[model samples]
Target: MLGLWIAVIALVGPFAAKLADVQHDKVTDYLPASADSTQVAKIEEKLPGGETTEMVLVYHRDGGLSAVDWETAAGQVAEITRQHELIGGAPKGIPSKDGTTLMYPVASNEPGANEEQRDKLVNDVREVAQGEGGLSVDVGGTGALATDSGAVYDSLGGPLLYTTVAVVAVLLILIYRSPVLWLVPLVVAGIADYMSMGVAYGLNQAFGTTVSGQSSGVMTILVFGAGTDYALLLVSRYREELRRIERPYEAMVAALRGCGPAVLASSGTVAAGLLCLLAADLNSSRGMGPLGTIGVLCALIAMLTLLPAILVLVGRRVFWPLVPAFGSTPKQRRSLFSAMGSSAGRRPLTVLASGAVLLGALALGSLNLPGPLKQEDSFVNKPEAVVAMETLAKAYPGRGSQPIDVITPQGRADETLAAVLGTPGVDSAEKGRTGDGWTEISVFAKSAPQSAGETATIKSLRDELKGSYVGGDSAQQIDLEVTNARDTKIVVPLVLVSVMLILIGLLRSLVAPLLLVVAVVAVWGASLGIGGLVFEPLVGLKGTDPGLGLLSFVFLVALGVDYGIFLMHRMREESLAGAEPATAALTALRTTGGVIASAGLVLAATFAVLTNMGLVQLVQLGFVIAVGVLLDTFLVRTYLVTSASVALGRKVWWPGVLSREPGPAEPAGSSGPAEPPRQPESLRAP
Candidate 1:
């Protein structure tokens, strides 16, 4: 197995480093597939020089722009046009009503659809449009915003990977408390991540799945988080087996025999849940499903196969100062979970009721979450584009600085242009390039872009102009909001149903799966609620990402149930081995609680690394999922589920065979000296 993994790593490892090179950060890559904005983007790419880069160079002063500012703006605009291949003629400057600002509309196809080239163009323009003294120069438009967003996405590659690895390494070192033990899982996880990247890139190439910075970044997180989780469960069990069995190979086989089913079930549930994302309308979300599933599956295969092989080869001494000596028993002590079990056992109903109420209260915070995030507010730090947009919002007031693209049939170009001009809120309309049976027309709204009035105008144009598609950054945002609503209605139930079915199959009971599903759903709501409380008030974020709720719900429900599976599976093992239901619950908690807690912390911390990313969406998704995992790990799995099982006793198993027949219980009047309480049969090495 070691030789096999070494060969696999050698062959596939290089692909991981290449994932970032193919990752696309285009706006259309994330948009809904059938939305007007998507169509517009597709058509734009087919045009003469491909998509045009449209931006505004704004020159301003506190009091009023001097004559020199106008000349500077004109000269810079002329220089930009001379250097680049602009679709339209050299742009003319428009003076603000207050006479304090001069804006020049610039359009160029030099950069075309290449995001890097487009950003370079924007940066070059900014360099030439620089302002000093009393003058202020800012570049604002859809092209500039795209450039800024690309920069943020580009930053995700190295920093996110490094941070996640560092975080996982630290957590593993702390959990294992051994220099050698920490390196094994971390290295294995890295290999799994590399394998996942190769598969993801292949998926993207063959299936044309959208490979965005967000999706790929998420894929890496899942690999590390889920991979380490499986490692934790296996290593913990392996440690226990080493004490019983003399040979490392036999011990590993036994360890896999014990924890393998639960790990498989857990990773399977997560993968199945994520695969439900394929039903989503949004391209990015849909693509994430496959990529995330790949990560989990790869991680699962590695941890189950390569991890065990390597650990077996390393032998028990790899545990260093705390080696599990052969034939030795684990030290007995009062554990934290033992205390928690006592409280839970004393008053299960009270504990369950209080937890439910607390969750309910936390769920209320969802009401306070900000509205859909605007393009200008999508970053944690204001990018140049966001800053430019903000400057335009203040200086231009009622005027929109960005153009609304209307793609019309070439035969109806003039008629479409007339209709666009006739739209209620249109400030201006002009003919653009024509190609492939279609013509592009630029429409400017009287209101600021993405404002209520501009949105109304877009709606009006779409309604009035038959065979025309209205799209721009503002229109894209509107489409994103609408499409996300539609996708939520379709995807949410599918996710719930899929996860429930997986749980039912794994647990082989109706009630337990339902209980887990309900618990995770509550965690999702509470996590979002927590985000609502902190995002705006504490983090100073203006709005939530449009897809945050849906993505978070899917992740929380799927990944959150992982620890539940670990706990319940152990309990089921105990119940099947003749332990009474209450005893099984308590024993499972005592044996598995610490491992589950450590796994949860590692998973949560890996996700929390996303919070440090530049994009607000990544941060929001990370925060909510991290919070949900922690909540599920510490409160729901440790306390609530255990309490409920104890409270319900045999009924926790329900229609399963273990629940139907009476478990092995102490007989009355059996007063002989008790043998050392028999260990659960499942825990013994086969």
Candidate 2:
């Protein structure tokens, strides 16, 4: 098995890094599939130039434009026209009424639909349109913004993966305390990550799955986070089994038998939950569904197969300084969880109530959260394009720097132009390139771009020119927000239903599954609330991502239930072996709590690595998931759920065989509550 895995790794390793090259990060790649903007983008590709890259070169002075500034601008414009294809004959400068700002609209098909080429063109324009002293020049438009956004996504591939690995490595070293033991899982996780990337690339080739930077980055995270989680559980169990079993192979088999179902069920639940994103109308969210599932499944496969084979080959000595010797009992020490369990056992109701209050308080922070983040404000660090937009917004008030593109039938060009000019809030309308059956009309709004007035103008244009399609950065943003809202209404319910059903199937008890679901939902709210409180004050994020609530909810609920499965599965095991309810719950905690905590720390840290990324959206997603996992790990799973179980006793498993069976009698030798019974050797089934 080890030899076979080694061969497989050799074959697939080379293709893994290639996944970064094929990633698509264009704005249109993330737009809603059925949105009018998406249709316009598609049709624009088939036009005369494949797809025009539009930009506006803004030249400004604090007081006013001098003759020298005007001369410089005109010379640069001439050079630009000489070097690049301009839509019209000579570039016409539209001077602001204040005479302080002049913007020249530049269009070219040279960049086509390639983001890299588009960025090159934007950069080239910036190189030529330079200013010194009082005059300032900036290149700002949909094309420039797309280039900047693409740069952020491009950074995600190498830096994001390396940072995640480094973070996970540090956490694992601290948790394991053994250099050799930590390397095994980390290596296996790396392999898993590579395999996921290769598979994701294949999916893109086969099914045309959209591979955005967000989706791909998320895939890498799950591989490390979820794969490490599986590793921790398996390794902990394997060590325990090694002390009891003689042969390493047999010990591994016993370990897999003990915790394999829990790991499988946990990964299954996460994959299923992510797959629910397929129902989303937003292209990015929908594409993330399958890519995320692929990541989880790949991690599961690597951990279950390659990890076990490698560990078995290395034998017990691989543990090195902390090696477990056969026939020897592990040193017993009082665990923090033992104390936590005892406290919960003593006051289940009080503990539960206190936890509820804390979560509720945290949830209130959501009220303080800012509004939805605008495209211009989406980056953690300001890009040149954003700076340009800001400069233009301040300099040219009540005027649009970017034109709203209207694609109409060529035969109705005159009527469409008239209707566009007559649209409320439109500052100017002009005929653009024509190809096939479509004629492009450029409409400039009187209001500042991305402002409410501009938004209203866009809506009015769409309403009046029903036959023509209105699309630009502003229109696409409108579509994104609307689609995300609609998607939330549809996908949230589907995710909830799917997750609840999975929990029920795994636990075989509706109440327990429902309990886990509710707890996770509360955790999601509380985590987001914490983000609301800190995002602006601590991180300086202007606003939250529109899809933040729904995405965080799905991730928190699905991944949070993972630890629940680990704990509840153990609780069920004890109960089936004739252990009383409270004793069973406490004993499960004492045995599994440490591993769950370790898994949680690893998962949390891996996601927190995303907080170091450049995009505000990624940072927010990472923070919420990290906080949510921590809450579920240390508080919800360890305290509240356990307390609820202790309080409910055997009734926790109502309608199950364990609940209906006769309770075990008290121990003959003990006066206090009897210790939870372990499964009899003869009764243990693999």
Model 2 clashing residue pairs (backbone) = none
lDDT of 1 by residue, 311-420 (tens): 98889888998999997987788888888988888889999999999999999999999988998889999977777788778888989889999999999998888878
lDDT value, residue 50 of candidate 1: 80
List where candidate 2 sits over 4 angstroms from the true fold.
10-17, 97-100, 111-113, 661-677, 680-686
Estimate every model's Cα lDDT from 0 to 1: 0.86, 0.86
List RMSD in Å for every model shown: 3.1, 3.5
- Per-residue accuracy of model 2 over 336-399 as CA lDDT, tens digit each: 8999999999999999999999999999999988887887889988887788788788777878
What are the clashing pairs of model 1? none
